[model samples]
Target: MVRKHERLATAWAAGVAGVVFALLMAAVIVLVRVALPGGADGGDVTTDSGQRSAVRTALALLPFAGIAFLWFMGALREQAGEGEDRFVSTVFLGSGLIFVATLFAAAAAAGSVLGESPQSSDFGRRLTYTLLTTYAMRMAAVFIITTSTIGRRLGVLPRPLVVLGYLSGLALLVMGANVPWSELIFPVWALVLSLNILWGRRPASARPAAPA
Candidate 1:
């Protein structure tokens, strides 16, 4: 009984962490976009109190969000367990790491635009957008696709979610850069996955035992 309860508690904790991962990512996106309305080339890189504070808050949330995302990724892999295919797992891991690296790179570049030296704002803006929209989102697409494939093969993810993942992956791959805010699909997908993980779980005692 104690073991069962412990497992339940652990699962709940993981689920909550996954949701937190999604929420934090969304928050960073929202806050940053809101703060940088003029964008990189907009020539409005003002260091006003309101914009600076919002940007600072977003930057502050990023490291923790990245950590939570890593935790979430590991948790998903753990749930997939020994049955996960090697090739797909490798791609999944690689893409996830790339996504994190590029995400941070973009954030850093964007932050530099708001620094005291506004001369490099244009450069920073270009680099940030290119890194985020062009590379990071493609990696995110790969991550989503590979994860969906793994879940499909393992019979873990639902059919509809698998379909959505594939569609979103395609969108990210083909149009992520062209479409504004398309990167958001990644976090949104994570949110759905986390909710599924939370809601689909059943207690061991609640699961029906197989008859001899």
Candidate 2:
């Protein structure tokens, strides 16, 4: 059976996810604006000031996705009831935590690349760019896969949404060869998943209501 605290937790998580999705969507807009004006000639793609700024903004936006994923997990856990196994919950939580960590790493790397003497050793440039891009895509993969798994098990998200989640996960997995595509996919999928979580009805708490 679902406990009162568990139900409350799920509702809170969903609310937080909704707010975070808005923030992340805003950040994506800011990033696109910042990145579009400059052509490829200014500097190395990774070290370019405009690109760095965009990456930083994107990184800052990732917490929303993380929060959304966490809330989805919370909802799933509550729905699973007492018979629900803990392994899936742990996987969801673990993946969400790692996703957040990767975002932090991406932010740091972007900052380093954008700092003064912007173009440093080629190795550092490549490393930073790789970290920012690769990790972002990987985190997207983790988010979609884990969430789809949890949603399937708990029957929280709609069927179409779950299918989209799987497709998004597969796209991210293959996105390594297409940087721009990965950038687009991550934010778009995150928004979709966030909306699904936020709009779903919350599981009921066990606590009885006081007399009206």
The prediction achieving the highest lDDT against the true structure is 1
**Model 2 — TM-score against the truth?**
0.67
Scored against the true structure, residue 44 in model 1 reaches a CA lDDT of 45
lDDT for every model? Answer: 0.81, 0.59
lDDT of 2 by residue, 33-82 (tens): 35532322234445466676675676666656556655655555555566
Work out the TM-score per prediction.
0.87, 0.67
Predicted candidate 1 versus true structure: per-residue lDDT over 63-138, tens digit per residue: 8888887888877877777899999999999998988898899889877767677667667767777887799889
Model 2 bad stretches (over 4 Å) = 1-9, 18-22, 25-33, 36-85, 121-125, 177-179, 202-212
Candidate 1: residue pairs that collide: none
| Root-mean-square deviation of Cα positions for candidate 1 versus the true structure, in angstroms | 3.9
